[model samples]
Target: MLKGSAILEKATGKDGTQSNHSAGKLLMIIECLADKSEPVRLMDISKELKMNSSTVLRFLTALVDNGYAKQEPETARYSLTYKICTLGSKVSSHIGIKDVARPYMTELSMLFGEVVCLAVEQDREVIYIDIVQSSTKMLRSMQRIGHIAPLHCTAIGKLLLLNYTDEQLDHVIADKGLTKFTESTITTKEQLVEELQSIRWNGYAYDDEKCEIGARCIAFPLYDVEGKVIAGVSVTGPTARMSIKQIQLKLQPALQIIGRLRKELGYTG
Candidate 1:
């Protein structure tokens, strides 16, 4: 059986120099496979990639051995396995999200004169990945990138819970224990469920001094290419400036920007 190590060894040149030719070819083959919906014949792959039949077979054999691809039993055509999607998901979870949202976060922070944050859920907790500080010198919420906040008491956190089932919500509450940060924090499972329903209807979430006294936030969901909520973007500030009245006033423009962002992310719904 062909091995990845052997492929790498073969990629070395006679002058004892390593080249990325084989790796590039492998990527081309993978892209070719991904472009097609059905399993592809070996000759088709070789023709499309302009590679030798034997060379393509070697790479395909290596890919099959490594579980990245599989061959159909009857037709002997090749197709990618779910392992490729798993790897892509892992990469997608970490990269591009921050880069894509940073400009929008900056725009919101500048417009609202408050902190704008981009966060995603990890292990049932909200993790702030990027934060754009307020443009103004006024007092704002002290939210830092990489800060972990409870899902039950944060705008972005609660917005991220839109897809959770009742059982999943119960599991989260049981494990995370809905620790009350303020009197406004939802401590009971029933209250949290009701709050989620309201968020679903409202199409956004509010943090009315729930996580910290005198702090307020409004959050909207950020979708992925497939229209799935991958993360959330929120604007947070002191209650004096981010009061309910002010939030209601700024909601339309904020949502407009968020809608543009969603479209940029390929979310149609």
Candidate 2:
């Protein structure tokens, strides 16, 4: 077997030690499949992953057999399968950081009668990792774990953005370019920078009709071992039930849970 250290030097890392332990090549293939606006062929996957066609074929065969990929027989194109989605949902539900939050999330939604969600900052946007829907007849988009959202609009997005260092934030802003979704969404880079600072000091962030009209949300960060923000937990709902005072009053419980879950996440800080 190849020594781990030898491979570590070749893998890329953001912190300088090229120590990415993930299945980088396979992940690259997955990325290509996701990046395409539509399903891709084996040749496209092979080219994107920069691997030999035969090697790519073997990988796809295994992935398809394992239910990670689905292939159209006539077209020979591959796409993500529902099984992969099921596995993703299962993993998100059982992740260490989210495990303790599940019970709390359930209670929080019930308490506020709103939608509770956990979001993580991935790449340049926010990815909904977990969500607890309160009312059965709620009027909002059904957010799945893999669904992506704008980083400058949602309450959780602001809270998660507050966790990043100034330099990191700059990089993200440069990449994502402060694209505005709704009219109320933060459009200026300067204003967003200011909001991030406020979020850090307040220990919470607010989204008043930014993500979706008539939806108001409040969010706070979930920290990790070093007091580093790993993800954000938030509650959102219709403006009628999500009034400012109600959101403020409900903030403490979420903040309290945030405190407990932070410790549970091994945050010594």
Using lDDT as the measure, the top candidate is 1
For model 2, the superposed segments whose C-alpha errors exceed 4 Å read 1-94, 135-137
The residue-by-residue lDDT of candidate 1 on 42-152, one tens digit each, is 999999888999888877877887788999999999999998897788568657878777888888887788888899888789998888887674554557778888989
Give the per-residue lDDT digits (tens) of candidate 2, residues 1-269: 22333332323222233234235655677778777777898887887677877756655665676667788988999887776676575356448656788887887788788788888876668888788888653746645688898788888888777666779877888778777767888988788988888887787888888778788888878876566677888888888888999877877776777677777767766
Per-prediction TM-score: 0.68, 0.64
The stretch of ten residues in a row with the least summed lDDT in candidate 2 is 6-15
lDDT of each: 0.83, 0.74
Per-candidate clash tally = 0, 0
Cand. 2 Cα-lDDT: 0.74
Model 1 residue 77 CA deviation (Å) reads 19
Candidate 2 vs. true structure, TM-score: 0.64
How does residue 36 of candidate 2 score in lDDT? 77
